[model samples]
Target: MNLENKYYINNSDLKITLEELKDKGIIYIENIQRGFSKYPNLIIEGSEEYVNNAVKQLVAANGIENSYADFYYGRLDEDEKNKVKEALNEREIVIVESLQLSKDDIFVHLNDELLEILLKLTSKEVLFSTFYFTKYPTLVWGNYGRRYPVFFKDEFVMETVKEQIWV
Candidate 1:
């Protein structure tokens, strides 16, 4: 079997199910993020008759659409949207807990947890883009001219923001 990176297909040419992929030679199966993604893709890694499997490719999903902001969130199905909402709603930090507040409280820097959330939104392209960090407090967005609202510390952040995601 000289096949490389080909899916574990049966004699009927239909790709084997996830359950079968493991039993018969297939070692890895996952959706890989490609370019400016729009949806899912299944890539099957090298395999043998249960013992000859070679770890050729490490499969991973895009996780969430973030770089293009305002749009990627909408592109996600209901389940992904819910997960994102949950992440944003988590409140384990205060401006004092992880962020430094300005003299008058008008401006606050990014919290570690929030910064992590923003980083994950960006596309994991071959060459990672630095916009995720450069555009401090705004999060990742593809729109060149759209003015993103500044995130304030004393607002109903988790409750109102997550709810407004649809609006």
Candidate 2:
């Protein structure tokens, strides 16, 4: 199944959870960062057993700091990666969502890899537009304009700074 969904979490809360995970030896922050940077909108879908096991591992390593289970890269380490991967492998399906950006009438760049995946999911009838902007001598940027026609049900989208790019 395709897991494409969006969530908004306070940055401070995310940071606290990361810190707690690190303290309990559940995950290495660096690994988590790498994963998030590489795959922002990742939908980790697993059976009840898989989810329970993964959560157990996470809790045993470190108790939950926040009530949410949103994983952050800066809080995961090598061992955590392996555990998460193992849990993912045992699951029946995993769907990753590609994030589409929009800002005050402007669209940001979409990573090529994400674009290819989106193309496969969308039909030819879908049209995409992008807008470019220049701000004095400071900088110039562009955005993907709007959301694509495709939809993701359970995926997680990480919202970052407007000027940042996730690839």
Across 17-49, the per-residue lDDT of candidate 1 in tens digits comes to 334423322212122222114222212222221
TM-score of 2: 0.18
Candidate 2 per-residue C-alpha lDDT over 86-132 given as tens digits, one digit per residue, 9 for 90 to 100: 43322211222122111211222223232232222221212222111
Instruction: Give the runs in model 2 whose Cα sits over 4 Å from its true position.
Output: 1-11, 16-48, 66-167
Per-model tally of clashing residue pairs: 0, 15
lDDT of each: 0.25, 0.25
Question: What TM-score would every model get versus the actual structure?
Answer: 0.19, 0.18
To one decimal, what is the Cα RMSD in angstroms of model 1 from the true structure? 24.4
Worst 10 residues of 1 by lDDT: 51-60
**Against the correct fold, how does model 1 do in TM-score?**
0.19
